[model samples]
Target: MIKTLMGSIREYKRDSFLSPFFVMLEVVMEVLIPLLMAKIIDEGVVKQNMNYIMRMGVILIVLTLCALAFGIISSRFSASASAGFAKNIRKDMFSNIQKFSFSNIDKFSAASLVTRVSTDVVNVQIAYESIIRVAIRCPLLLIFSLVMAMSVNFQLSLIFMAAIPILGIGLFLIISRSQPIFQRVYKVYDRLNNVVRENIRGIRVVKSFVRSEEENRKFQEVSQEIYNDYTKAEKIMAINGPLMQFTVYTCTLLISWFSANLIVSNVMTTGELTSMITYLMQILTSLMILAQIFTMLTIAQASGDRIVEVLGEKSNLNSGTLSIETVPDGSIEFENVSFSYQEDSDKLSLRNINLMIHNGETIGIIGGTGSSKSTLVQLIPRLYDVTSGVLRVGGIDVREYDLSLLRNNVAMVLQKNELFSGTIKENLRWGDENASDSELERVCKLAQAHDFISALPDGYETVIEQGGSNVSGGQKQRLCIARALLKKPKILILDDSTSAVDTKTDAMLRQAFKEEIPDTTKLIIAQRISSVQDADRIIVLDAGGINSFGTHEELLGKSQIYREIVQSQTKGAKVDETE
Candidate 1:
């Protein structure tokens, strides 16, 4: 785990190394200052020598300034290294997430990933900074200060030996108790973020249902969980302060009592006792710093594991070495294809689907809920690879093509259409970044989106809110269709994309497809019977397999499922006409 995290410290290696080097110099200077004071007290004051006092005072001033400079440099370098390391880690995690296949993505929730990138990275960044500066400085200061005190008077140093064990054991117990609580706190944070995200995305449903108070209660529940866990952890860690203070004062009293007798007996100088006292504070303060670092480590250790889990995951789908750049045609074939979300599970989402689609053909797919109609179409673009058989697009296996090339050739407007926060032109340009003004207007017209857009105050340049919240549902769908059309893909799959548009507009969009792009194959997935009745061929899916594949009239005479669906719609239409 340490090696994996260290990999992201790529460009910050120099800053990381420099931070500790300067910290060492600062600690050395600090240790020397105490010794120099010992000199002025013993040599200058005791002997009443003005020249020696003046000279030693000058030396102490120079040493203090040097220590301050080293401290500043260490802080600057440490800050740069820690912040840069976090930036690099976030970039690497995001880049890796982009490479993850749908199967890999399923292993982690959206909220968890967001927490890892933002909160978890920040926790580790602080730990990293502490490791380079405080972690390095404290141990060295403790050891050096102990040696100086012992050299001054070994008997007085024994006081610290007793204090050390008590502080160490107290700190150990505190950290051990708080470790698990800190781990649980971060996990709860993920849940809290997830709750907030869901509430925001479904705010409309929540308001329409008058569930704002319910949502507020849920948010408070998750928020309270986090608060309770943090309070528990802090309660355990709170022992550190009083424990350190008790130990420090106890050690100080013992040192003072022992040395006072020695001073009266003329065995130890007052100057030496003062220096030993300074060294005692240095030693105990270092121990306190070490305790703080351990507390941070407990939190960071859990966060580090979460980060490593994402970085270590390998995407299940691999783009093969031999890249097929050009898609010869829009032809798609599914030969004995079977898919399941889980490989070992007996249940399959799609099964034994043997079908062929020629270039420029318009195919309609209809199925009941959970019939895997969307699953079938997703496999064509290798969104999720088939578990058992071959799925070929453009006469080549999708895995063999460059992932970018294959996706570019096969454009999919999914069931849930998403439009980003940008001007209408900008969102449309996602399909073709270099598309011109005329090309943008033409595709929007084809999707029957131009009229509504033109009615808006800004027309094509209208700024869309995030998720296109400013636009109506039908307008959002048409804009998504226009965006997909901008791709000019050899194959276009509209998975219930026209469900929001009126029947007339839907028909006009289909007619525009036939007239404008004759050579491009179109796959329409819809619920309405009228939607698929005019297709070149219609596929009826049932229980994860193809029940029939034929023209509308052929299916009406042959397939039971297709016939029932048509009759049901016809009866509903008749009832509406009579009313």
Candidate 2:
């Protein structure tokens, strides 16, 4: 764990010893001020020397002001350094997440990543601030003050020096025991955050089914676990506060008692005894700050290790060497393709699959669930790598081309259409940043969306609530289609895209698709057979393997799986060979 933390701290070379050095300057001022205070009290005040008192008094005041100014400056510098530090860490974490293979993502939940990036980053930030603030100051002042106190009178300082090391051992024990507890608290914190996020996102369902109490109970279980861990850690940490106070007060009593005897015996002047007593108090208080610093350092390190885990992940799909001076329309071919999410992966999603698609052709992929239909289409954009295959886009091996270039030519309307919180026009612009109003209207018309959009009070300017929640399912689908159309991609993929539309609207969409989409290669993944009946070719998948490939007419006459599906879904009316 300590190595993991040290590795993360080493990530930002700028944060290397420099940040700590700036912070140590603060410790210098903290120690200097207290010593000046002792001088003012003993040398200036006790001897009844007004001039000596004023001279030291002014010097102490200036140092106090300088310390205050330094504290503020150091605080600002620390905040700036930490802010950039956390930002760079999160940036790397996001980039790493994007690199992780789909299989890797399945091992962790979205809620877990959310907690790691947010709450965990905060813990690191707190640790960074502690380094600049209490952590450095306390330890430095304590060490320096201990030296000064011991120098003042060996016997009196002995009382404190003796107790402090014992206290130091006790502080170390508290930190070590509590470190594991803090990690557990963060784990439970992730679980609790997961429940809260799920509940809030699914609140409509809970309210609709009147299951609020059930949800509350579920939330309570996770929340209670988090509270228990936090309470245990806090309880353990709370011990240090009183233990420090007890040690300091005891040291003070011993010093005061010895000081009185020294002065009465003429072994020490009144001013000298007073100065020694003051230094003893300063030394003990500084050690207390050191105690808190030690405790927080342990926890911050745990948090930093998590941040490092995210930064270190590498994506499986590399942006290859292919550059597209010009895309060769939308031709695609797959040869001897076999793929699985794991090694020695015998559960092939596509086995010995050979297929070719030309520019301006319409292809439909039909498969039952678990047949890897989506996974097959996903490969075109390099979302996942095939375990065994050579995939070529535009007559070039996909791995030979830059990943971004391949994706730019392909537009995939995902099963789940996502829209950010923005105006309708703003969302549409994602496809074509420079698209004019006419270009926007052109895509909307092709998507069968113009009529409804015109009906809205603000038309294309209408503000959409987050995730397009304010829009109906069909409207959101049409808007997503419009957004895709605006890209003017060389290839378009519709992955079960029209599930929510009425049959009439679906036909209109297909008609508009045929008329307006300029002979680009189109891949349609559909549960509805009628949607793809007129396709130039249809591939039927069963049990993660391609069972047959032919025109709709050929499939209807030949494949049994295709026949069974046509029989079941076509309602006994003679299944149309060509719609």
- The C-alpha TM-scores of every prediction are 0.97, 0.90
- Pairs of residues at least 3 apart in sequence or in different chains that clash in candidate 2: 99-315, 322-400, 322-401, 322-402
lDDT of 2 by residue, 418-492 (tens): 888988999999998899999999999988888999999999999999878999988998899899888888889
**Model 1 quality (TM-score):** 0.97
Residue-level lDDT tens digits of model 1 in 100-214 = 9988989988999999999999999999999999999999999889988999999899888778888888988999899999999988988999999999999989999999999
- In model 2, the runs with Cα more than 4 Å from the true position are 1-46, 95-104, 572-579
Model 2 residue 542 distance off true place after TM-score fit, in angstroms: 0.9
Q: Tell me the deviation in Å of residue 66 in model 1.
A: 1.3
- For model 1 the local lDDT of residue 432 reads 98
